[model samples]
Target: MPDAASTRAAPTASTASSTTLAIGFEGSANKISVGVARADGTILANPRETYVTPPGTGFLPRETAKHHRDVVVELARRALEEAKASMRDVDAVCFTRGPGMGAPLTTAAACARTLALLFDKPLVGVNHCVAHIEMGRLVTGARDPVVLYASGGNTQVIAYNERRYRIFGETIDIAVGNMLDRFARVCGLSNDPAPGYNIEQEAKKGTKFIEGPYGVKGMDVNLSGILTFYETYAKEHLGAGEVTVADLCMSMQETVFSMLVEITERAMAHTNAKDVLIVGGVGCNLRLQEMMAIMASERGGKLYGLDEDGRMDDRFCIDNGAMIAYTGLLQYENGETTPLEKTWCTQRFRTDEVLVTWRSEAVKRPASCEPPTV
Candidate 1:
C-alpha cells in the first residue's frame, strides 16, 4: 500500500480543469466494465462486457484470464466512443486493484498500465468494494450511513469511522450473491449473461416461501448452510417434479434477504447512523429494498435504495466504469494513489482495511432531467 505522502496530489481547485476526464476499468467477477467520467462526477460513457463460465464447471483461472485479455480492448474502445472521446483525451487511468480473482485483476492492471503508458497519464488502483459504496453515496447523497454490501465475493455491513471504514459485520463463508448464483445453477437457470437477474425474475413469480437457516453471529452472517439445505431438499423432493422453481426462488430470496435486513437493521441501531445505504449486485432486489425501506422508516431515518433509478442509477451498479472512476478520482484527490511498483491484488480484501477519506460534498441531481414520475 502507498502511504498518503507518496501519492500525487490532485490539482488544486483553482488549477483544476473543468473537463478533466478519468477512465476507469473494472474486471472483477466475469464482467469487464469501463467508464469515463468528468472531475465533478458526471458519467460520460459507460460500457461493459460480461464473460460466461460454463455451468457446472468450476471457475478456471487461466480461462478467465484469457477472456479478460481478449475482450477488454474492445470494451474500452466502445466506452471511449460512447463518451465521444478517445484514450488521448483521458487525464487518468483507474483499474480495480484487488478483492477479485487474481487472473482478472492482473489482466485489468496490465491493460490499465498499458493505457497509462500509451497516453502518458497517471494510473490509479481502486478497490471494487469501496467503489460500490462511493457509487451509493454519489447517487443517494446519504453521508456517513451504514452500508449493506451483498455480492458474489462479499457480504458486509460497513460504517465510516475514525479515519477508515470499519466492517461492523461480514460473511464468514460464501457471499449472498454467490449463494444465489449457485442456487440458480442448481435450478437450471440460464448461464447466459446475468444469472442473478434471471433468478430475480424467477423469484418474482414465486408465491410460496420456504424457510432456511439464518446464521447471525453478532453482525457477521453465513448463507452456505441455507444454500446446502435448499439444494438437498430440491434434489430429494423436486427431482420428482414436486416443487416449482419459482417457489424455490421465492423462498431463497425471502430467507436470505430477511437475514440481510436483520443485520442491516441491527447495524443501524448499533451505530446510531441516521441513514442506510445498500450496494452490490444483490442490492437490486425489490424485496431487499422494501425491507430496508420499512426498517429505515421504523427507525425514523432515511433509506437510500440504489435501484435502477437512484441518483447513481443502474449504470453505476452491476460493475461499471463510472463508479470505479469516481472512486479512483476520490483516491487520487485524497492523495492515496499507489505507485506501479507496489500495486497488487487481493482476492479477499476486507472493507475495514482501507480508511474512508472520501466525503459526500453535494447532492446529486435527479437521475434524469425529466419531471418526476407519478
Candidate 2:
C-alpha cells in the first residue's frame, strides 16, 4: 500500500520473460569491474580490479584509465570463468557510458565495443547512476523504492516517476563518498583497502560528536563547506589535541548521513513511496543505514539497504560491472541498445536524462517484507 502521505502507485514489473543473460563492463573510476547475470536475478559472476594510489593522494583519471585498459580483458575473462558460462550464453554486452571520469568510461566503452563486435552481441550503454539504483532494487528486492544514491562522485535523492527516475535532490559540490575519502586522505589514511570503512570503524570509539556545519539547502545537501571546515580543524586542532580524530569522523558521518536521510524522507513524502533504498558506495555505511532507518520509521516507512548479505561494503557498494550488467539487461528488455558508433562515454550524465520504458504501474512492495516498527 502507498503511504497516506502519497497517492502514487508503486511500479509493477512485467511478467513477460526474455533471455536476461548480460555481461557488463564498468570502469567509471578507480575500479574496473565485470559482471554476468540472468533475468531470473541470478548473478553468475562478478569480478573487480582496483587501482590503488599512494597514501595522501587521490585517484587520477589518467592513472585509473591506464589501470583499466591493462586489466579489463583479463578481468572479464575471469568473470566468465567464475560464472561457468561462455560468450555463447551472453545475450548482450553492456558498459557504463557516462557520469563518471571520462578516461575510465572511455576505456570501458572501447572495450565493450570490441567485445560486442567479437561476440556479435547487442551493445548497451548504461548510465552510471541508474546502474546503482537498479542494482539496489535487484539485490535488496525493494519495489517502488525512493532511492538515495551516495557515492564518491554523486549524492542524489531519486524517485521513479513517469518514464524516469527523477532526482528530487542532489549535491551542489563534492559527493558524500568523495568528501569521506578526501577527508580520510587528509587524516593521513591509506587508500589501499578502503577509506570510508576505516573511518566508520574508528568512529565507533568516538565519545563526543564534534559540532560541524550541517549543510542542507531545500532538498539538497552541501558537504563542501562542512568539509572545508573539518579540513581546517584537522590541520590546526587534530595535532594540537583540541579535537580527536574520532570526534571528527563520528560527527561527520552523523551530520552528512542525517542530511541525506532528511532529503530522502522528503522524497518519500513527495512520492508517497514507503520503501527507501540507499545505493552507491556510501550506502554501505551502517551509520548511514541506521540514521535512515530511524527517519523512515518515524514516517512509518521502511529503509532498505543493499548490503546483499554483507558484501555491499566491499563488492556491491562501490562501482562494479554487475550493476551495469543488471541494468543493461533491464534496458535491453525494453528494446534499448546502442550502436557501436554511438557508444561514447560521458563525464556528466544526470539521473533524469534517461527514459525508463522498463517498468509499469503494477503497484508492488518488497516481497516478504513487513513495515518498519515504530
Count of steric clashes across candidates, in order: 2, 1
Runs of candidate 1 with Cα error greater than 4 angstroms are 1-17, 54-59, 306-312, 360-374
On residues 267-328, what C-alpha lDDT tens digit does candidate 1 reach at each position? 77777666788888877766777778888888898778444553324445567777787778
Which parts of model 2 have CA positions greater than 4 angstroms off? 1-19, 306-314, 362-374
lDDT of each: 0.75, 0.80
Of the candidates shown, which would achieve the greatest lDDT relative to the real structure? 2
Q: Per-residue alpha-carbon lDDT of model 2 for 216-310, expressed as tens digits?
A: 99989889999998888889988888788888888888888888888888778766777788888888788888888778778887787534553
Which clashing pairs does model 2 show?
12-362
Worst 10 residues of 2 by lDDT: 1-10
Residue 64 CA displacement from its true place in model 2, Å: 0.7
TM-score of each: 0.87, 0.90
